[model samples]
Target: MISPVIPEDSRFESDPDEVLGDNHGLPAGWEVVPPDPADRFTVARLTHLLRAHERQGRGWAGSGVDDVLVEVSEHGLRTRENVVVRDPEGEIRAWGSVHDRSVGRMLFVHIVERGLDDDVAARCSDVLVEWAVGQAQAVGAARGLETQQIDTGAFQDDERQHAWLAGAGFERVRTWWQMTRPVTPEEAALAESPDHWEKDGVVFRLVRRSGSGLPDEDDLREVHEVLEGAFVDHFNSSEETFEEFLHRLREDPGHRWDHWWLAELTDGDAPQPVGALIGTVSESSSGPDGSYVSYLGVLEAARGRGVAKGLLATIISDAATRGRDRVGLEVDADSPTGAAGLYTSMGWTTKYVTESWHRDVRVSPA
Candidate 1:
């Protein structure tokens, strides 16, 4: 690894235990540097570097760079939290970030140039994992959480990245299917049959809006509550604060209050939220193109009541009414709830598959 300099303003320095390369495995004139805060330079650099790899049919179709940058600007992300590894010619070769999702939980994102040789990519990935584990450990310590899981993923077909993650001691825990359904205004406008997409004791509709046409905060809070309760038994789920949940969604430029929806179970004397679905506008290289299902959940007590199906129907119909080209969602392949099968029966097809790998990190008191 080349000797590299850390700018004075770096947010978090590499911890000694992490044994992070001083220069982050930079080779020759290469450098690992924090993102530039004042401009789109960081996001643009990341997008460019990864876009080349994706063209080779391995990487994910991430939320477009535009919407991602919106998260950095409106959410809690800071430029220094993610770094770019650039070659001498000023072209980025890799990018990495650690999102501290919650106490004892972290999400690691690492992407390297798909064109790189196995040895080169391995070196880059190792250095980044060192830093990511260090970052997660620090956050865990601060939160009084000594043990945490830092996770990363790769396309199932990308054996090279899999080898790298396996080398880092992460075990493959699960897989996911990223699915999408094509929609036309005409198809979406199809008349709904009462028995279709609905169960006898469930009522589903779009989230309510107040007089000013803004979604009522009460309804928004209800969505969060339902999601938290519904995902309790889901694979690798943890509670997210209401504030974080709300602001995180708002960070997406495609987030519109109108796209939030709800499902209520009415079997009891009173009706209460048993399911919820939140969607965001989707864009293509050309421009605005479709809608994406960011979150959908049905409480365990309400599962068989068709709350999930009803919520999905509302989204599909709404996306059609809005002239969206398609609807997309992600499901865990190993979910006990069989969420992937549900999406499949609803006409969504798997567009791609990814593997999830996770490493447990132990932190001592700082």
Candidate 2:
């Protein structure tokens, strides 16, 4: 099958000033190469190459490369790179790229180069930091930079990435724990709620895409509210518009309507869904069995009475029925409710840990 067509806005473009200029005072043989639309074959080759690096336990992977390329090409993003080093043959040895984001007038260093060797990787990382500082300066001059954010989750496994961030003058702002649970025949059987847990005033039901039909505007609005309210106090809590949330998920390679759920209290004259769990199956490198569980939330008022557990159990059963091998989710490491404990009790294991890093950017003087 042909690869999904990514719009022009998502691909990278060559920027002469940023790519050719001195990268934060480092001596350079670097050049920023745009994601040439005509270079589709090269991009695919790079994707496979990056995945190979990931399998060999390299710090970088290809999880979001497609999305990045698409954004650079079709989204009108001003992506820039600092070429810090080059081989004698002029091949790129070390470099980094910076792109803009929707929140917090910030620019993200999406890709950072660590040389092929460990010593070279360290040396290249140091130069990448300087380049990042320069990018911050440039962004501040142009758009009044608020903060510089780089997610090492895409590359670093755990504290290793954190150490690099700290060494680069970044601070750990948050922690995300990736959790996964195997879907077994037992889980499908266990999903049946006990009579005592069942309530006269409320009921739990599974919403299948085929059975219920496509989710309408009302369904999307309700789920949007559920997630907005659920994560209001969590780390990096920000209200995302309905359009933004839908757009982002729709862009995912694994998104499907069947993997979503909505819950409601049955006692009311007109019951509305008060909780939801939206998920997608990923056949990507990190997810082979098509992992699920993208976003799950329960309204504050709907807490207790087995709502959360019931929703989770229902989704797990759904995954099993659909022939999924495992379900995955990322939970805040410091949840006040100890959600990680809940997931653990339900059989999810800590597969890996990730850290979020942030650098406060000084806006250039007007």
Candidate 3:
């Protein structure tokens, strides 16, 4: 292979080895190999290219590639679960990764260069999908699950990737709106009636953490329990263990204990943690600096009593009091819960759209 015409952003000082997919007898200059920590810069460059083509660079933190590499390396994920397609001349044209997202599911991320010929792009995408499926099987084999599903997504406007997913046996599942609420500079000056939106008998509180600065297991479990009950009937909801929920969330760079809150009712004999709201420091994307609602879960017993609104008021008040720009969140586009409408009523708007695709794979646990 010849040396690559490295872009300033993609230049790499290298050290690497191993292949993740079936690379035998590949086209003259094309092959699939496992991702290496050394490939961080190249992957970032490819990510920027893929994202720019999909109009996704607006608020990206420029840390995706490095972050993924760190994730696979630092976590239990194997390098073999991620791959890069290189042209015969040492250029990275595509990258594919599969992350086991608890239960029997894996999240797939694949990026192919649009500048390549259609057939070339197709071939590369096909190889990446194949790799993702193989990784899914490996995940299933390890987890003792008889079957597993691979979940992936593309920008709602990216038809080519959608077609590739369909051809690979994935079905379009649902669309989500990346909604953001802009915090007006003057909103900070407005007095926030902390419990005004709260139900008459309910109280809101933050998840209590230990003096050691770690989240109390009891509190975290309650958060997970509340989320489980709240989203069990939601579209595409999966059965995930509490460990899975906490670990995956902790992986995010902005995760913090203080950002988690609860809606409780204690007027009775005991306090009931009926709803939970998990927020993270947001990377400003077309909005002033703010926080993002990663998960807002209200138990069935707590719905319709203004619990959702109360949880939001808590977040908005906290952000405003702290001088942050706004509080943002995403919602299901076709939710049966009228979630989108609720967000709109509360002043959140659809900023962008994303689509989800899913496919199943059956495997025997080793």
Candidate 4:
């Protein structure tokens, strides 16, 4: 739901003031306004709303204040637009954010305060989705595309969310298994050390960083190339430029250069990049931090060579060595790679399930 900002789309802009100028079908006395992340009150209200939404949908909250703040931050605003719905009494009752994620995909967040009158809540959801559709077209036109896909997600158990998404013309397209594995001190031995490991003619190691702490550009490009090739046949895979890829990953609050890893097949005289794994730290306010696998990909040629398993093991070992409590990742429930089985074998278990909802909107000629 969160990522680094893409470059500003100046050609087809959605003016914030104009966004709220129209009711867009919101009930009388309710107003939609651009959110200011710098405002403590706004951030607090958004955080509270997110926690409320999460609690209602999944019985727990996984996002924090920082996560909310990131949505409306100046840097985030480069490729994102956010609005908060206020009731007659001037309290935020809903929040909607849209990201121009890539050329054909636009990410949307539809959040409405729980416990409101059912009709009012339903109307809020409708308005948010409608706005998202409009934004998708604007983003698509800016990219000179004919169609854009609105991609949003909902918890599998949240019937309310399911109904809202369905009513708004989105169809459930995919299911994901959110899995986690507890890290123990003993698991640190899974790898000889965190720096690098070689076995079966393959070498797995962290993405090289320079003396100034920036990752080597050559290595970064190779990692990107490996992932792009690996996912070419995967479901819903779209081509993202190297700049967009780096910007999005770097924007994560948990981004760590050292958490990035690459695997090379060294069977021949020259080592060839065959796989890449990008990880991030998942911080918890009340417990030890956890490691998260943000992205893991192995070239088709390297599939049977243990490249994916090696990358996963390296992250798990790195987590254990860092004293992290656990490692978390999301896998497509119907993945052709049989990744879920591999994760299960490595002691990971599904903690929750989430579904992706999508709507493809056509951009009208200007």
Question: lDDT per prediction?
Answer: 0.72, 0.59, 0.72, 0.86
TM-score, model 3 to reference: 0.85
Report the number of clashing residue pairs per model.
Answer: 0, 13, 0, 0
TM-score preference between candidates 2 and 4, better one: 4
Estimate, for each residue in 138-166, the C-alpha lDDT of model 1 and write its tens digit. Answer: 76776677787887787788777777888
Task: In model 3, state the lDDT of residue 113.
Answer: 78
Best of the candidates, TM-score:
4
TM-score, one value per model:
0.86, 0.75, 0.85, 0.96
- lDDT string for model 2 (1-366, tens) is 112222234222235345236443333544434444345654454455445545444344536566435443443343333232444454545435564433433344433333366555565567656556655655555544454344334334544445667887777667778788888756665455421123435555544333346656666667778888988887766556676566656666677766666778877788767778887776765544555788888888887756777778777776776667788899888778788988999999977666567776664464
Best by lDDT: 4
Estimate the lDDT of model 3: 0.72
The deviation in Å at residue 198 for candidate 1 is: 8.3
Which segments of candidate 1 are over 4 A away from where they belong?
A: 1-25, 57-63, 67-75, 78-80, 189-199
Off by over 4 Å in 4: 1-12, 16-23
